[model samples]
Target chain A: MPAEPPVLEPQFATAEQQRSASVLGMWVFLATEVLLFGGIITAFLATRVFYPHEFERAAGRLNVLIGGINTVVLLASGLGMALAVHAAQKGQRWATLTWLGLTALLGLGFLGLKGYEYFADWRDGLVPRTDGFDPGDVTPGRLTLFMLFYFVLTGLHAVHLSVGLGLVSWLAVRVMRGELPRAGATVAEVVGLYWHFVDVVWIILLPVLYLSGHHEAADLHF
Target chain B: MTERTVSPVATVLTFAALVVLSLTTVGLSFLRMGPAGHLAVGLSIGALKAGLVALVFMHLVRSPGRTWLAAGLGLAWLSILVVLTLSDYLTRHVLPS
Candidate 1:
């Protein structure tokens, strides 16, 4: 059976035109997202410049092993998403759904690891602005500032990942109903863009948040 | 939009590179790099990984000029924010008291 062409919206003269518009809109939205996270990152960097030792010490307390594993997990998920988009473009519905399912699972795995890491942080008394908060050897004030940045950055990232997970799962449902790879390829492509962007954010976060300090402890436990 | 397809080979290669780069960043942290050294190395590796993701995984290379413009504009604005903010913060102690 021949693939059905996407329904052209009344405002757009051609299907091609409408698809481009949708993609462009998504990219523009992603650009604004860049600035939103970028602003917080800038503030973190400036604060680090002021008290490098405190920040590094604080970062050292973070669980690098978890962060490192999540980086690879997210990267693998990105591969799944890229493959899903490729399959969708070829009009392979089953392939698209399979890849999408795997992608969402990997995303869930990332969040799971992140949640475990957070729990470990709580056990370690690293959560800032709490009665049980422990600054260790670092100054309490600067360490609290660093912890605030950590929680804010990672918390926002988890929120974005959760959103991406919802989008991917929705695409999977559409693919199952045969609504995708025929008329919904653009939608898949757009969600793929969002998923990869989230992975990119995590990639950037890994180094900034987890790897900027000396790791004297060689144990990967917790 | 043109339906450009990335080969699975290329996609896998990008993923491998990203994983390798991630490990490299972590490994570098074990060294006794001073604060600036650690930040520079970590962020440099990070910037490289981000570039790969943007160009390959994000499909920026195959995207049209308008899309490129949007990505570029985002980077430009981010640069302005970082440069301006750091200038003041990094230079406050430059003048002899």
Candidate 2:
């Protein structure tokens, strides 16, 4: 009989049991998270049903190029996170740290790009009810509502990204200190679930917020 | 001896597929599909990308049935909320005075 790892509570007979319990707990939590964002998405859809043209026109004003770049940035971050989990499972502490560091860096880069995009939107007077508001052809009030959704959705996603950064940073430090090996790889894998959940949110947001608007089609030839 | 870890190559491949699909969705959005078609294409692709991340990057594919149940429950509830709400709003003839 091999000794159980420290991560195994007395309630669990084996490390594998402990890991499955923890992972299942995370999934349960994520299910609630899906609804947290789902409510807002449902509301957005309902609003669109009433003002489809205005919403589409409002969406057109968004910067799709920047959104596309951010999507790629987020996807790259997911890749780093996945690799980090792989390294952690292999018990390669330094490799785990390296990959996790890369993940956090990419996450920060995504935030930077998001900040710049927000600033550009501010400059374009996209913020509703501001003195320099630009409503384009869309009704100002309805456009404001659309922009409201944009800010709220992206802002919520940004908050999640920041939380993920904190989590990844903490994981990296633990990896460097050789603390995570004692617990096996469950901690890192759990954190990866949260990180990838955030990425999934952004993946959904990109199309709804950035691509739905009928702004001029992006010229791919360039 | 019993860890179920995804390969780095497989992770990289999944990332590549996600990126390519994203670009394809963006390109498809430019095709002047009417609003319904446009949204359907973009959202369908978005769902696809999200599924990839959940399954591969999050390692849900190898996860236990309990985890799948938890995840599925969330989506099932979301569907109930969305469908019920849409049905109510879409079928309503007029607002109360």
Candidate 3:
């Protein structure tokens, strides 16, 4: 096979230089994303520290089965994305498309499960800031605060995942059309970085939101 | 680029590790640790999982120094925010409502 033409831009000295620059730029953007979610999480932690029991009680009401399933789904999606990038780097167009498709499907699966979880939360009256707000046995004020954090965190994450779905789909289309040549694999790599970062956020959230309160409820039960 | 690309075997192994760690987090949650203990352990495991994802799947292990700097800067700033904020809340006595 002939050497794939390099996709070097005007300013970049070489293809490798361009790839590094793109990766670095993505990292900087991801750094800002870290601060965005990090700030919210800090606020949640500060509140939890003050009202640990309340937070625990509120957290116990969360659907752990759904959360765990979503964790696996998102992680699988991340793996697919990594494989997609790997295939792209090797100039395997069909493999790249296949992995990207799988990644998007898994992402959609995560969102579908999340939507179901949200529906369950609504039916349980766990959602706050609305007319149907109910805190069950926990203090209304604290449960409301916890639910707010839960919604905001998960909702923001869902939005990001939706955007990721769009990006992955777009890339898949390009790959199918032969527009994204092997040299342009850096595009897939950068998108993979974002996908993995979102996965990282969900991983942190699993414990912070789901696992923190389960032991208390278990203690009461058994 | 070939050198930079993570082998399929390594990627699969990282995925398996993440799955096991996630299950462990769930399993640990069944133990009767108090709120503080639960939070500590949960977040600790979470941090570990996050580190794995960052180092391997995110390519930080093979990333350039500048990329590592960017990642480190994010964590450093997050620490500053959390520590400063917690210092105030954790030190204050909760007035009984």
Candidate 4:
């Protein structure tokens, strides 16, 4: 007798059903992710409202150049990720794979650059001034608090980026195996949605954390 | 991924242009902007870039009207969350000056 064919598990009844479910599930998941970051933003806003001077003084010590570049990198990655989904949904397999690969490559590039920037921060003595750091940029005491927020927000975003890359890698494997179907491209679509949401978070974060204040510096670092 | 709304080349090129836009936006941040001005412009550019990406790349433009509605609802609710929480922060009294 012939061997059994692989059992294809039907997550939903039809392509339309899958698409609808995927979109709905992604939207709900995004709601939760929004609240997660929402809490962080709320805390930041509260701190800023109460201690505008202190926050500004602290923000000034951050590397605006790195933050700005990161914003562009993430935004571009979002675009690429969206395009990947677009290509996939339309059954343009080659374009889909190309865009997907580009997206993943860009994601990895961002992580690499982020690592380098983080190292630079440590070298600059930005590891919480309360931990006996003195970067000679701001009041050591307040600077410590500022770095604390900086690490918290961007660090979390970085963690999200890693998770996103992992997701993309898994999706890529499916694509390679032809398991990621063109007709039912819900998984790719939803993953792209998650990716775009993360990018939006970074867009808001860069300005708030890096460029929130401006007092003319004697020497522009970037 | 709706090909009907846009072409492959169009999507890729638009993304390229947006990449350029993002670079310019970041570059502008180095110019002197008071705190609020800096955030306002930078975030505006970010929002625009995001919108373009969504419209062209995410098939939001070509998606059925109802899908767009679902998306709008999602974002609206998200904005509500931000605004409501922010109201408290903005209106709070008795904090260090």
lDDT of 4 by residue, A61-176 (tens): 67766666666677678767877876666655667778888888888888887888788788777777676464355456766777788889888998998899888887877666
Query: What is the Å distance of residue B61 in model 4 from its true position?
Result: 2.4
Chain B TM-score of all predictions, in order?
Answer: 0.92, 0.88, 0.90, 0.83
DockQ each: 0.79, 0.74, 0.70, 0.41
Error of 4 at A18 (Å): 1.6
Recovered share of real interface contacts in candidate 2: 0.74
> Least accurate stretch of 10 residues (summed lDDT) in model 1 chain A?
A129-138
When summed lDDT is taken over every stretch of 10 residues in candidate 2 chain B, the lowest stretch is B88-97
Model 3 lDDT tens row, A18-125: 888889999999999999999999999999987898888877778877888889999999999999998888788889999999999999999999998898888878
Q: What TM-score number comes out for model 2?
A: 0.93
lDDT (Cα, tens digit) per residue for candidate 1, span A12-60: 9987788788888998999999999999999999999888998888888
TM-scores for all candidates: the values are: 0.95, 0.93, 0.92, 0.81
lDDT for each residue of candidate 2 in B1-97, tens digit (9 for 90 to 100): 4446778898999999999999898777666767767777889999999998988898778776777889889999999989999887766756553
For model 2, name the residue pairs that clash: none
lDDT tens digits, residues A30-144, model 2? 8999998999988988888888887887777788878888899999989999998998887888888889989999999999989998998887777876344565555678878
lDDT of 1 by residue, B4-69 (tens): 667788889999999899888988888888878888898899999989988888788788899999
Worst 10 residues of 2 chain A by lDDT: A213-222
Minimal lDDT window, size 10, model 1 chain B: B1-10
Q: Which candidate number maximizes lDDT?
A: 1
User: What TM value does the first chain of each candidate achieve?
Assistant: 0.94, 0.92, 0.91, 0.86
